[model samples]
Target: MLIIPAIDIKEGKCVRLTRGDFNQKKIYLDNPRDMAIIWRKQNAKMLHIVDLDAALTGEMTNFEKIREIVTDLDIPVQVGGGIRSVDAVKRYLDIGVSRVVIGSAAVTDPKLVERLMKIYRPSQIVVGIDAENGIPKIKGWTESSGLKDFDLALRMKSMGIERVIYTDISRDGMMQGFGYESTKRFAERAGMKITASGGVTNAEDMKRLIELQPYGVDSVIIGKALYECNFPCQELWYAFEEGITLDHNFSTARKK
Candidate 1:
């Protein structure tokens, strides 16, 4: 499992929104490049970035800044937010974005998925299916898609989408823990590989997620907990640098 760090950018600043609430946002850094560099220096293999401004407005507000962050990192960065069309996806990919995540587009434009997949290959595309009480949320979690996450996932899978990032809006930015059972339900129903996100609190949480690796939860995205130092980040950084994979809880939970 990979420990991917998140950089949520709003108004050109790195910020995080609690429970996907815009009014509840807290700025974490002035420059997103600085945060990307920090995670890169910490030996992160990949970075997850979301443009909060674009997510709500459907504009590439911080495209240049995102380009800078992507340029500075030797690792890949998967970017999301307001990516609606083939041109936007192409523009981002042209500038070195490893994968482009489609949120609202995935729900509103299913044919766009087919077009993008045909051109960029499946690995270069990711769909974010964020849900609240099983219904998929779109347009930065402000609008309901009137479709269950599993239904959306099934559509994406049928359209040849290989990977998806599943985030539970209620748990996002709350540091509660992974929405394992819900994610499992989606994974089982959608039958696609998933990267679980939102509310990952600590190492134990990571262990639990790792254990779900067999259930199509290949990796997870952690934000608040990691930013708040919910676990031994320094040690984990060293381990990442050394290519050391620590068994989740060293078998304590597995013993059960």
Candidate 2:
């Protein structure tokens, strides 16, 4: 499984919010570019970025800063937030983003996923399904969409979407660890590459996720763990080098 680090941007700074709430937020870094460099230096294969402002307001508020990080990183970058239209997605792809994650759009308009697949294929587009209490949430997790999380996953699969990023809204920025059981079930039902995100606290959590590979969880997106000094990239990198695979011992090339 791939360990992907998260860099959530708000007002051009790296920050984390509890349960995706705008009020309970903490700023970890003044500049996200430095954090991106740190993750790159730690040998991360990809970075997960979310424009919190954009997610809430449905605007491309931090596109310029995000573009800067994308340009500076050597590895691929995947971006999510306020990408409600195909034109916005085109802008990110034109700027070299490896993938664009559509969350609200996927919930509100299922046709958008079909249209995007026809234009960009399934690999380039990822649907981000953020849920609270088994129901999908949208508008940055502020509005509950009334859609069952797993049901939506099945729908996305039916629409020819090959990958999705599932995040537990209740655990987001909580540092309590990921919702492994929920993720496992979602992956099992979807039967596609599911990148788990939210509430990832340490290496143990990563271990749990890796064990769920049978459910199609190929990667995870972590944020508070690194910011709170819980899981260092260097240690995880070493663990990978030593072949100490977690969550079912799936071996992978060590990122050095």
Candidate 3:
């Protein structure tokens, strides 16, 4: 499974939100491109980026910053947030984003997905289905869509959307642990390939997610765990080359 790091851009900076609350954001880097470069250096195969400003207001707030990150990294970068129309999706793809994720647009306008899919290959499209209490939330998790998360997933699948980024908003950025039960159940019912997000705290979490691969959970988007070193540190990549054993009790790469 690919463990992708998230570079959530709020006002052109790297940040994380608690439970999708914009007010509780924590800025970690001034230049999101730096974080993207850091992840690439760690041998990450892909990256996930969310435009917070666009998510809230449906604006292209970080297009330039996103463009720069995609240009700097050799790996694929999938971008989401405020990509509601075909124009926005085309813009991102035209600018070299490997994939474009649609959230509110998927929920609010199912036809748009169909339209985009007709123009682009399914591999270039992804639907971000972020939920709380089993119900999907939109408009940056501040509003309810009144749609059952599983039902919506099924609907998207019916629309020819084969991939989804499922996030349990309640567990997002909390670092407690992934919501395995809810996530597994959602994946089983969604009947589509899912990229798990929210509350991925450590290597153990990655192992457990591996166990859930059977349910169509293919990849995971990790945020705070990576930034805070709750997972096995990126240093382990080099340690593996040095023939060093990285145990649970081993000293971490980060000083904190």
Candidate 4:
């Protein structure tokens, strides 16, 4: 299973919103690019980035910052947030983003996904299903799509979407625990590979997710816990690099 680190950009700063609540955000790093380098130094296989400002406003507010991180990191980076149009999707991929995650568009514009699938390989496009109480939420979790999570996942699967990032909004950033059952059910019903997100607090949560790997839950996106050093591994990494400067160009052997 892949342990992906998440860097959510709001107003050009790396921040984490509690329970998807924009009003309750905590800034972790002033420069998101630096945070990306730290994750790379700590051996993150893939990095997950979300432009929170764009997610709510539907504008690529942090595009330049994201592009900078993408340029600096050798690891694959998957980005999501306000990627509503085909042009926006192309823009991200054109800049060498490994994959572009479609969120609101996946719910509001199903045909857009169909059209994108024809142009881009399935591996290059991902659908983000953010849900609250089984109903899929769109536009940065501010509105509900009036469709169940499973329904949305099934719809994307029918459109040839091979993988989805499933986030349970209620548990997001709470650090209470993960929505394991909800994620498992979504994967089982949709019959597609899932990258679970939201409220992954500690090692027990990770262990639970590992148990569901057989059900198509292969990886997870962790934000707050990682930033706050919820895992022991992070503690060690931080201690070892406390005074040492990081070489941003440091590279990991690419996984085959």
Task: Tell me the whole-model lDDT of each prediction, alpha carbons only.
Answer: 0.87, 0.86, 0.88, 0.88
| Deviation in Å, model 4, residue 62 alpha carbon | 0.5
TM-score of 4: 0.91
Where model 1 places Cα greater than 4 Å from the true spot, the runs are: 237-242, 245-256
Winner on lDDT (1 vs 2): 1
Per-residue error for 237 in candidate 1, Å, reads 5.4
On a 0 to 100 scale, what is the lDDT of residue 237 in model 3? 41
Clash totals, every prediction: 0, 2, 0, 0
Q: How well is each residue in 6-74 modelled by candidate 1, as lDDT tens digits?
A: 999999999988999999998889999999998876567899999988999989999999999999889
- lDDT over C-alpha atoms for residue 31 of model 1: 98
lDDT of 1 at 197: 93
- Report lDDT (Cα) of residue 227, candidate 4: 89
List the pairs of residues colliding in candidate 3: none
RMSD (Å) per prediction: 4.7, 4.7, 3.7, 6.0
User: Model 2 off-target regions past 4 Å?
Assistant: 240-256
The superposed Cα distance between candidate 3 and the true structure at residue 182, in angstroms, equals 0.5
User: Tens digits of per-residue lDDT for model 4 on 1-256?
Assistant: 6778999999999999998888999998899999999998786778999999899988999999999999998999999999999999999998989999999999888999999999999999999999988898989898989998988888888989999999999899998999988888888898888999999998888878888978899888989999888864444333323354333343222211
Worst 10 residues of 3 by lDDT: 236-245
lDDT of 2: 0.86
